[model samples]
Target: MADAPPPDATGAGKRRGGTSGKVADFRYKRPAQPEKKRRDARSGHERSGPERSGRERSGQASPLPSQMRPDAGAQSRAGSARRQAYAALDLGTNNCRLLIARPSGENFTVIDAFSRVVRLGEGLAASGRLSDVAMDRALAALHVCAEKLRRRNVHLARSVATEACRRAANGERFIERVREETGIALDIISAQEEARLAVLGCHILLEDGRDGTRGPAVIFDIGGGSTELVLIEPGGPVPRILDWMSVPWGVVSLTDSVDGPDGTAAGRAARYAAMRAIVDKSFAPFARRIAPYRDTDEGIRLLGTSGTVTTLASLHLELPQYDRRAVDGLVVPSASMRDISTRLSTMSEAERGTLPCIGDDRANLVVAGCAILESILDIWPARDLAVADRGIREGILRSLIAADAEGERSREELQRARDVTRSGASL
Candidate 1:
């Protein structure tokens, strides 16, 4: 996906649940304000992937036109580009998410979006395979994605699988099953590629240090079975990938590594500490690798696009429900996040589940997320944690739109060359 044009605040144009799904005319909005203002707006509300057995890298999509904000009705060829809807599907270990939009000038206006937590990596760490129950759970969600793709009549789309499929022995088989059962072919992407797409998705929200540089930024994504940490260099339409590494640690994998989220608060606390210790070791090599890039002079900014950070952000704000507008571009103090993680670690499953921000589905798994979060804080220890609700889905969409723009530019250049040739012949 490419850098998004500031989104027009998305509202229900014509939303309703149907056979394909609910809410027609879905709009994925980006804030018009600078990322800082958007982050500041969150002072109130709390807010808050894939087995990739596939190691295939995502090729960049066509470049988008300068006039791409479709919700604004920018002019284009007006024949095909106007009607062509682009789509991106991300099937991760824990969830299935899809976004559909027509290229709206330089940016896209999301027409529809779907997200469901399927937890496909459930029990995979212990089993070494995707379980039948987990497969069924994921398939059901992919079916919905297929329907959205079908209903939208998507012309250009990319669907990908991440760490879960990459790790599960049965990952390839499940990909086949998805194609057979739902007609949605999923490519299992490599860890390196996963890191790239995530950077593509949310790098726009990264804040340059006070000196006005984007380098030395550590952006991470925490999924169900794996956590990806990407070190971004300054410049380019997307952040230059200086270095990246994927640890075999995420909510589902981490939670399962410990005894269940039961037992006394003291027991849970001990488990959390143990989880943190393991993560500390997992991240040590990368920490040493990135030692030179470390800088907090202008500012050390850490951005996270994952459930763990988002949930913790929501908890920090004490919001009644998870809210994207508040969470997406917001930056919170790293200390505040660590404090929230500590609090969650000390609570029982029942207590965490009851919170609107976390709820039952995430109750047990989130503590492991906290451990991962804490471990990250231990390493980067940046002043602020930037949260992005968007990830690979946005990355895929942007890539698709950029591909279109690149193609359009090629045609325009060719036409200009032909016109020049004709003029020379007349002379």
Candidate 2:
């Protein structure tokens, strides 16, 4: 199926930093202060706010202009030409990623990007706290992120720490230390917000429903410390999130719960079954809640964003090495995924690691991820699975770009109002 249209800027309108799913008018409100201050209600220094500043990205729809004072119009267009670069940083349980880009047309162009698997939540599952080793590894990755932001001269940025930071007992302390050490503020967002952003960033890749298939689509993000599943009703500027749920079971967490080593084939299978049972139980509530949506005439549309799906998709394609271009947006048979999951469960960590995509870093954890994916597939029963290389970071960029455009629109409106007043006074 062909891809859906990229989100239109007008459709996005003025949104705080998170979910803007409402279908009503999207009006841009100019902030009272030039630099809008973010309030930290829980932690004194933890900053949280709607992304308020940045220049708009390219490829977004612009406001239709009426007769304007030529000078003011020219000035506004010229100002837009001086595009400001924006950055979005997502520090998840297993990886730290950064993207720096400037508005291109309706979308943006990536100027610089960075990604590293630091396993920030490595020991959080068993210890219930971030280990010193894990923290140190994460900080090393963040230090690199900070330098990139500095060199890029980012005009606006939003940094977020996900499941690892959200669940670990030392999460807050770690956030504080990150600020003190790297000069980066990390917002530990709720799982609900996390799901929304994942959908926002990747929904464009959803394939249109085929004949005999229509209705709400299932979009999920399988992370290191947790997994987020979202049920969205498609059609419109943005898909409306009808329901969502987050389970504590993720690759790291699930792997931690199971035994240390894969001894025999039977032992590995048992461990895999145990992992599936854990996820299935966690997903039961959400599965029941969304059962009605599944009964619709349309086929179940499922899209997944995470290392698990990407890696599995890569294996399914028989890629000698990992390739983002070939994997992202690729759709595969659900049976194929299930077969791969079952196959991986039987193999030892060493054997799985030898494969092109599942290296040493992911070897121990991939089994847990496969278990979670199978559980999701079991409940949703989508015939095909869609893969997304983009997620929270991409979503953040879209939000920042939309917010910047809203600000510009508001300023234009104000300018037009002032011009009208002057014209009346002259008359």
Candidate 3:
């Protein structure tokens, strides 16, 4: 959870500084790659095997040119120059996403990525078990993700399941089916790990030097099933994680709790407020614990990752369509965010669906997400917010690569030291 390094202000396409001295750069570009083929001709031919348990048997196919391919020779070079690639997958309450990238200098390039809204925990709030319909939807999305991973030729990858799976009694069974059908394994990560990765993934976005004195900035990730909050200190070999917690409520879970499956505007609004109140109440204990970190003199900045912030960024720009480039890492004024949240609150589901940025797929669920974001804002009251499109997946990828590189370096250094010691003993 190391604090992110300060951003390079002179870089092309960076955010502009505001009166509050917060930067609002939104210059993210989707990694350029060839258009992916919809269906693989050999997909049907792949056999299902039980070589592993829980989604590990979803046999993968050969990767396409657009996916990441590492050079083995490069990996044998010096540790810093190693050309190792890493991959991470996040199967949360709503979306199933995967990212595979090869480290390039200080930053990594996205070679291939996949995302789909599965709403796995769609009815888990009331049912206490994953609904058959929700499971089917999640499996379908996971099938596509498996195909993408196979096509991308991912070598080292970690897939994680969050609150939905953690809470459900049938979660293990669901994971088994996924492995049998899709050949992917889902590791249900702990709340602490979730918070750590959320901070790791988004830390790069909070690189303003003005907040150097803050012992640890508060980082929050609002997902479909839960919200993860982490207090992280800057300037370390790694980020120092002070505190972390996972609230049981997220957009999908809260929506299901408040409004039934068929969430309408009135239903959504009422639920939104209720959900907000619940979340506010839950935060009181954690808030009191971290009260000292809120001092402005310490320079605490709020970093948020998830649909809530990304959707807010999209609405702020009034995009004709959902564009990750425009929305990712965009900073929004607290007032502007509140205004957008207010406008969204007043709109019916149908009206919300009409908005280009929020299609029917998100009309109902987005309100829950908005309510969560608004609540966090009210609690933290930061003048500016740094939005991140990257999250658990990115964090996983970075951690894997960083760990691998460090291990390789450590091995080499140990060998060198051993040789020196042997020479001295011989003399």
Candidate 4:
């Protein structure tokens, strides 16, 4: 709730102090929709009434993603009122991903999706600013998202930039450029909000705790520039956040910080050890705080939502290629995960690239991810590691939909009250 930084030369808000935080952008691009609709969505936004677009009548809506299904009444609902579409864009240090969805009953159905590894945080740990090349890559990806938003006529949308933007000196400058270029505002969310969103998005996949005695669950999101670890008390509509911490030691940051030759076994081991030590130190405070949970009757339930865990889960499944249906919601043994991490940590980048899921895009960085994962295991020692492909984007969509629902209910109530007032006046 603090005042945003003052505008600098670039017209983007300038950070006063060297603070480590993030910004997240929320937008609703309605190129095809009416100007009033666009303006309204920008301020308070649309309600998810059954509003059908031309495309829906034409049966041109994009198919839902693998994780979601179309309800039987989806088509009927589309005709009721204005079908308000929502979009969530997550521009992280390592990847640019976008999801566009429409409310379908209690859940939203994804209409379109896009993902590309832009590595916006590349060299950020060393440079303390977003490099031109990285920014260009991210902008290119955002352009695609912008186009999609326009074509989909997204009524409610939010685009968030994580660790990379949060850590860079010119983060706001780049955000301004993004807004000017793509008409998409990028919000660099704080670490705590990032952690909360990640948990909200993926915690549904947590294995039932009622099967046995349940302990507090641990949900961690390993991003490109930073990693977030959140502890929660389960058994509620949504897990209540017990405690959490965000460390600036994700794949890109860790790998850049501890650079060495990993082509050889000895070299890889040495570099991996360095990475672990750094993460261990970064996580020491959180570890000490959660020491009590380690001794619970039922050990910690750990759920991970990030490219790191998904890639590892793919490797565990020995999939021919990355499959979201197979990887998402998977429960892998902790020991097995540790073994995979160790094996991957030792393998040279080239060797790792040759594997099924850890291709060239993830070759060099997977080792750092492994190190972080291992350090997590060392602390929270969970029996099983649950994998989630969903995170911030899903969380954003859910929030937008929930807000829309509330707005819709309020509108209905107001209408009913007006109807009663009119009747009384006529009487």
Candidate 5:
């Protein structure tokens, strides 16, 4: 592996020298926890495990489930002692997400997960800056995530900020403040890395060539400030990554740009249409890039990872509340996605808020997000759409673990090579 960039160069390891007055001035009361005991027990076990090893144990302490030990290699890997829980926090354009898991053989079971729509990119389209109201909402959510991270006793944690923070002028300042106040360093990753990690996170969901052969699949992540699309060919060494483009539009950005509160059905339709047109135009280049793969008769499946698609799945199930397991791998028909999009677009903000899936916090912007998803499907026709609740955060965790493993192997290889050279020289 190549040397990692300098700490300051990559925005991953830079530490702000001192806490800011803004951070020191505010005294935050600890939030109440209803399930404190469960959290405490989990953290206690995590703390008792090996400190440096990246291996994660099954959440079950007694014996690993047969289902959890899927393969021989996984079983062998799990035989090792467990280590600290690894945490990945993604502060995206629309949401703040965190995943805590210990490595368990080939796969990791989520010990705890947190997601909340703060719409940090709200008003960023027009203003080119994160709004104060949005920042407050995001900060509150981050505080919750930080507390959870602490309770999990995460030994190695990585927090990242995406498109909204990447584009905003004050993004660095906001990150600095977050570190000083919350002690969470936010890494604003480039679009390429973002695309790579999303594909990695969703790689397991790619269709295996069992029933019938499927061609390359396209994965789309409709984020708050930007959208990422990746094309993957099944049974291939790696995703060819035919094309990846982070469009300057997402749920929050698009909704702020086009939606209105006119309280009229026609107005809402017009808003949806307008938003659709804008997204379609933005996706034109991406469409053209994937056009060559479309004509081959090799069916391309669409896998969507973001709040937009998962929320639509939640609503389709008529779920009273969001369930990640239910929505994660759920396959929604294109027709069904269209139906939900239409229904959501027609409802007033107030009406949408009252719905089970579209809560008060996300009611207004979800339609815009849906429109983006619908527009992409329209352009890139797919047999079925897979919903993934995981994305950047999962990708980050996987990459960090993989990178650490690679680094260790590289060090061993280097030492062996040196020893061989020395023996040859002595002989």
Candidate 6:
């Protein structure tokens, strides 16, 4: 929707504005699957139909992410059909993101990507409804997404709405409006489904524990209106999902719950304490259930895939601004995160706004994220917070790509509770 910035001056899109957003060189932070065979999947009400690769749901082939070859015309079309493009669009409570990509061997190359903070769940915690301004902002972003999908002719695409939509009273009305206005139907996914997709998208970012002594890793997605905590057992082409719980708390909703855009140092600490207390109450039951796994004898691995963790990770690195390459898959010490959170808790709103990563857009809300993050650290008590800048979108890409390699996968891919290998790299 806007012009791309000039090439990176330092050769890293670390600058505030640039196309570094276009093609992310994801380390463990980045980079899907097959056809008609569907399951009573945990990822939502999965619709199993004909083979589609980010193509529109017409049951006709678009030929972007994959190049199908007829037994007869294999040689003639071999070099001609290089690759087809696939896309994943995620319209969450706080942000809207779209990834347009083409399959490259085991991974897909990002050709275009878009992200905007729409805050669709802005006041949902109090009002239990999507506000007018928030809906308008979301609509504008979805328009951009629609234009990108039209321009790219994405082969197979899955666009989803998360906690905000699930909670709001007028959510379906807004979904209808989206279809009417942008030609995009938003599916309000269940919490369990969201947890599953999040895992499919980000578990690879977990620190390796394959030596056996490392405890099962905990992966969490701190969304706008909710947080999905998943326990990932050590195994697979991907990490195994042992158990998961979706707590009803996220940055936007939590911030709305405890209002304090003003106050003294003491007052700010009080606000931060309030936010932390809410998260602690929400996390208590889940924490108790996983008490046996809380031992430190074997060492614990905690991983996070969300804006909260990424923002904190960026701040931990003290970057000039947001840098995906530097932040994604980074292992930040738990102590550094706590120290940053403590300093932020004491900062004035204006003071926090002046920071690079926590700008005006995120200034007020980052504190809420900090509360959630600190609470999570308390529960898992891991030494390092494994951060992933990628999540649900990456998960969708993996699922679409893996459809082709379905039955032929190894025991690791099939068993151990569902981990996948993307772009052929053995995770």
- Lowest lDDT sum, 10 consecutive residues, model 5, at 61-70
Model 5 stretches with alpha carbons more than 4 Å out: 1-82, 209-213, 411-427
Cα displacement (angstroms), candidate 4, residue 336, comes to 0.5
Q: State the lDDT of candidate 5 residue by residue for 1-427, as single tens digits.
A: 1023211212312222222111111122233444774476346545533321121212421101010111213333322324446667778887777777766666565676666667788778788888889887777677666677666656456677888888777888898777765667777766656666787777666655324637777788888877877766666544556555667678887887874857788888888889988988878877777788876566778899987898899988988887766787788787899888888889888898998766776787798788888888876788678887667667666665555455457867898999999999999
Mind giving the per-residue lDDT tens digits that candidate 6 earns over 88-128?
77888898887777766666677777787888998888888
Candidates' TM-scores?
Answer: 0.78, 0.81, 0.77, 0.83, 0.77, 0.76
Q: All models: lDDT?
A: 0.71, 0.73, 0.67, 0.74, 0.68, 0.69
The alpha-carbon deviation from the true structure for residue 243 of candidate 5, after best TM-score superposition, in angstroms, is 1.0
Best-to-worst ranking by lDDT: 4, 2, 1, 6, 5, 3
Give the per-residue lDDT of model 1 (tens digit) for 1-427. 2243111111111111011211012232232446664354342112113432111122232222111222424345536765687778888888877777776656667776677788899989888899999998787677656655666666666777887888888898998787766667677776666667788788888744533644478889999888988877666666666667788888988888877645787788788888989898888877887777675455466899998888888888888887766777888888999888888889888888999788887898898988998888877878788898877777777776666656667888898999999999999
> Which has the better lDDT: candidate 1, or candidate 5?
1
Error of 2 at 18 (Å): 11
> What is the C-alpha lDDT profile of model 3 across 189-235, one tens digit per residue?
65656766777777767666343534356689999888877777766
Top-TM-score candidate index: 4
RMSD of candidate 1 to true structure, Å: 13.0
Once fitted onto the true fold, the runs of candidate 2 whose alpha carbons sit more than 4 angstroms away are: 1-78, 210-212, 422-427
Clashes (candidate 4): 15
**Candidate 2, residues 263-294: lDDT per residue as tens digits?**
89989989998998889988888888889888
lDDT of 3 at 324: 70
- Give the better candidate number (1 or 5) by TM-score: 1
